[model samples]
Target: MDWITHEEDVWFEFRGNSPHQLVPGRFYRGTVDGYADFGVFVDLAPNVTGLLHRSELDKRLESLTWEPGDDVFVQVKNVRDNGNIDLGWSIRQGENEFRGARIHDPDGEADNQPVESDKSEQTATIKTKPVSGKRRHVGEKSEPKSAAAETQSVETEVVEAEPETEETTADDESRAPTASDVVGNLEEETEEAEAESEQETEEAEAESEQETEEAEAEEAELPERVSLGIIGDHVGDHVTVEGTISSVRQTGGPTVFELRDESGVVDCAAFVEAGVRAYPEVNVDDNVRIVGEVERRRGELQIETEDLTVLEGEESEAVEQRLADALSDEARPDAIAPLADHEPVAAVGASLLDAAEAIRRAVLESRPIVVRHTATADGYVAGAAIERAVLPLIREEHPRDDAEYHYFTRRPLDEAVYGMDAATNDVTRMLEDRDRHDEKLPLVLFLGAGSTTESLDGLGLLGVYGAERVVLDAAPADEEVAGETDVLVNPAREGADARDLSVGALAATLSVAVNADVRDDVSHLPAVTYWENCPQQYLDLAADHGFDADRVRELREAVALEAYYQSYQDKRELIADLLFDADEGLAGHVSEQFRIKVEDEVETAEANLEARDVHGVTAVVLDSDAFSHRFDFPPTALLVDELHRRNRDGDRFVTVAFGTDELYLRATGDLDFRTLVESAAAKAPAAGLGAAGIREGRIEFLTGAREEALDAVLAAVAEQF
Candidate 1:
């Protein structure tokens, strides 16, 4: 008889067997059907399949050379009620390797008797067997099969065996009783057996319940709650810990809860099932008690939770208070003695403390930080300073090697304002990361930018999604800018001269406040921002840190050149070498290129400068559109600064670079660009003389009102002088 295949009745018709008839812990012949990254699927019957999990393989999954439709052997580890089959690896790849035949009857008792395969009946033709009468199980050795069993298509073995003894024969005869004896004693035997079974079942259930109660009692008698700081000593021991949940992350196998107590933070892992959420009641910022055994994973200590319970009422309040108190004491600012007397510095220092605390909280919670800054030497220096301090802290907190990249990012913007373009880009990246990788939303830190009302639209977009923002700038920000951010650190907002401070100087101060150990490395950065007339206080600070003017200039120029090439990338390693390790010769080589590029641009701008007198003030104006390399290095800001330095002789002098739609301002006298632009716009409203770009010391005006705009701007400059 030949076998036939059918789609609707595939399993029963293909082999005269169904998957429901599969026996657990039994070996079966199969064919490789398909492969997956995790395991392989094997076809045992037409419609019955089983998975050979990667974990059960003696060798790597990739090492298996089997192809689809190839014959293979496997053991059925289990047959679940849902009809799922789990398979284990088999060392006996050939059918002859197995001993003991099973004579399976369709409707009768299946016995362990070697027999030949009846092709018409679809049964196994197992022939090998061991010498002993006892049946061999999986993983046991079997004796060699006789030549007849191997050669004959349908053959049976006639084995020489011992005959039954007199005692066995007599016992068998006594066990087989007559019909009269069976009917007479059947009721009594049935009653006794039923009573014994019930008694045994009752005893077993009572013992199980008692063991469960005792285990629960032991869990309830846990010792006093201990701090996570002392958890290292309690490894391999069961203990109880109470804390607030800082974060919760789900993985392929376990759910990790980041617990923060007064002492420190640790991760507790719980596994209910693969890809299933454990302790579904737990959430971030909730107070809970975790009872588990401490274990080490990937060289970091973690808790294997046996029981977890959320706290309420007084318990929750107590844990929250403890964490708050500990954070306050540990993260409070200790000293700003470096600039205490400077009221502007002191005011910004207070805000620095707040910003640092917020950043620390984000770190503790495993939230990412996105730093946005202007694409300038000042902005890059400031942004790099914070990056240096925060990276080391992130690495220390998160044990993974890629934590720095995952938790922190620094992006340089072409303009100072955080407009819709920049915000949209950031939001897209963050949302994608959250969806694809299960990452939490990030905190946006605006350094050296986003301090004007112009950025409110961009900030509002982020706020709509509950993302937080922090702004740290030296430019005087609009009053409304403070309301748009979580932490605003600007001296001008607190009544001080923003002109005297550089964003680099302010941000470096804040970076040290974030991590004090980097103070010596960042102290020199403030002095480097001043091209001339350095403040005595900042110069003294730099001198104390052993950074003279030449070394400061070298670092400043090196960073400027690098900022121009790949204006988008953070260039982390290159900038770190240039700023932190000045002796590496990288700064010298790059600074030389910076000098050559700036000198060429400056010489051209000076030659084409159109000088004029406006209301007794000497004004130097350059049509940068005609004379400058519009697409080259040393931007308009740097060009104007160098022009003012070389040409200005009197107190009332202003150097201006006119672009297509905007103007750059650099002056020798105490001229407030913010005040000048505001007053100018009021005088000539049609000229569009606005302070929109005041953060970068520039103003936008209507091209049609060129003469009126220049006159209004120069009048304000003259008045201030």
Candidate 2:
């Protein structure tokens, strides 16, 4: 169908179509909707709303008489790249003002159905599930009943459908109301109800017996069973699969049952009403046989179940025997050797094995994994390494193509410590998943954090819920942290110098230990974690694994920039493309952005540096909130770190960047961070100054006492020097 351009002053109205059918430059009748200070929003169709700017109004906005639901005319001005529609006020308020009024349509195909009529057509089969290629109304059978019943089967429905009202007039009350008349009607209704009850009970007993006999005979017939691994081959064909239900989740459209057989696992969907749970009798761990038609939904294979019947006796035994092999084969594999002969990687070998085994066992048992890491280049590489490794294993273990979504997740923390807020959020989500989706508890893995005393409360909160925790830290760890977690793998715990090791290198080692098949994909990850002075062994591995030094820096910079924006989210595919599959030049383009943004920020910060000789030590203080890009890339901490990196002329100079209530310190020396904080707190007791952590090199103080805190900290630094 060809669309024609209409002449000027032509107007249109939308009946119930979406914005996809809308045409620009044509006037449309709409109702004034959501209010705003700048303009009023107009609803042209159910899902389409356009903003009519105040500048387009013919009269003052306050003086306009239009209320919500008032009919007005507007012309489509433009559609934004993000699908927002801009509308201009039209002077043609009445249909007679336009040259012609037509309905905006798609390809000239008119939609003439009323919205109310469409809703009414769905009433009879509203709450139903399709079985045997036919819709079966829930709570109502098709069997013939005695005509002795009332118009409605349920009392609630009867009252709602035909509400009783007093119709007697003042004069008619004297003539129409005898108690005897009311009593007589009540007696008739009571007798009919009793008979209706008796007939329904008899019919139900007979139906139940008949269904039992039919089910037994049907089972004896034994339809051919299809393996879930090959279910994709039978798309649109009805087939049976013998399995045990692993989990049940009620979605908005259907009740999805995760069915696992010896071949693999798949999902079977049965619908009843919108948001209504279907197959209520089917539960997790129940042995059953399902018959459904194979289908592909969003590129993932699924089964639309027509019938789900529980199996007992001989049938149950057969299902158990069929699934025996798949169960036994899920045992954890032996951990692989580290990628290279690095002391830090080999120091925590025992803990690495434990971490790898726990991950593999979680996959085999159909448990979900939640990874927490700081939003940094090293952190993302760490998370993505495990992410890339576990995703393929999930796909292979479960028959469903979407198994990875159900099994794995990675969340980035803005702070170095997993505070109570992050723990509460994780707990809330896991509890909801368990109660709503019947999923198992997730294994919480901390990639670079959760090994400090500051994270103790958050870790303890997870422990209360019995969530298994694994903490892999490249930083030095507190001894108490080892007691709170299931596995703590830190180079400091093994007596190795954890100062030089990056989280990315340790995580990639653990990723390979989890699955050795993708060793080549992760071989270059360790080298990308370091901006400069990367270990020789990691560089050699990167060269051997097909990533040159330039490519490694490109991947590293790209992740750092993307990680700062939306710091709490793991942009999975974007990072995956940069790290693993950047044959399409995505890395170079993003890295270029990283360099530009950082360079601009660094130049601004350098121009405003306040250099001073405080307490005989060279101190450069930067008022970060006033002079730096506080909300953009190169976070205050990262910017200060970068500033110190570029301007640390010698070992005597220390970079100090202060915000409203916090200050960051960076220096290369034998200064003890703990002693410095203690001395500062002793001098300015009212400031309440405390070191955030040694790794972050930050100090937290009261807002009112910020000046005193800075003075005290500078004096303490002199003592350390």
Best by TM-score: 1
Report how far off residue 236 is in candidate 2 (Å): 9.0
Candidate 1 lDDT tens digits, 224-311: 5789878888878888999987667765446778787887778898866444678887776689999988876435888888889899
Could you give candidate 2's per-residue lDDT for residues 119-176 as a string of tens digits?
4356553232222222233575776656543333332232223544576354566586
Evaluated at residue 359, the lDDT of candidate 1 is 79
Model 1, poorest ten-residue lDDT window?
A: 5-14
lDDT of 1 at 17: 51
Off by over 4 Å in 1: 1-218, 221-226, 271-282, 305-315, 339-343, 347-349, 425-443, 460-469, 493-498, 672-675, 678-689, 702-712, 715-721
Q: What's model 1's overall lDDT?
A: 0.78
Q: Give TM per candidate.
A: 0.67, 0.65
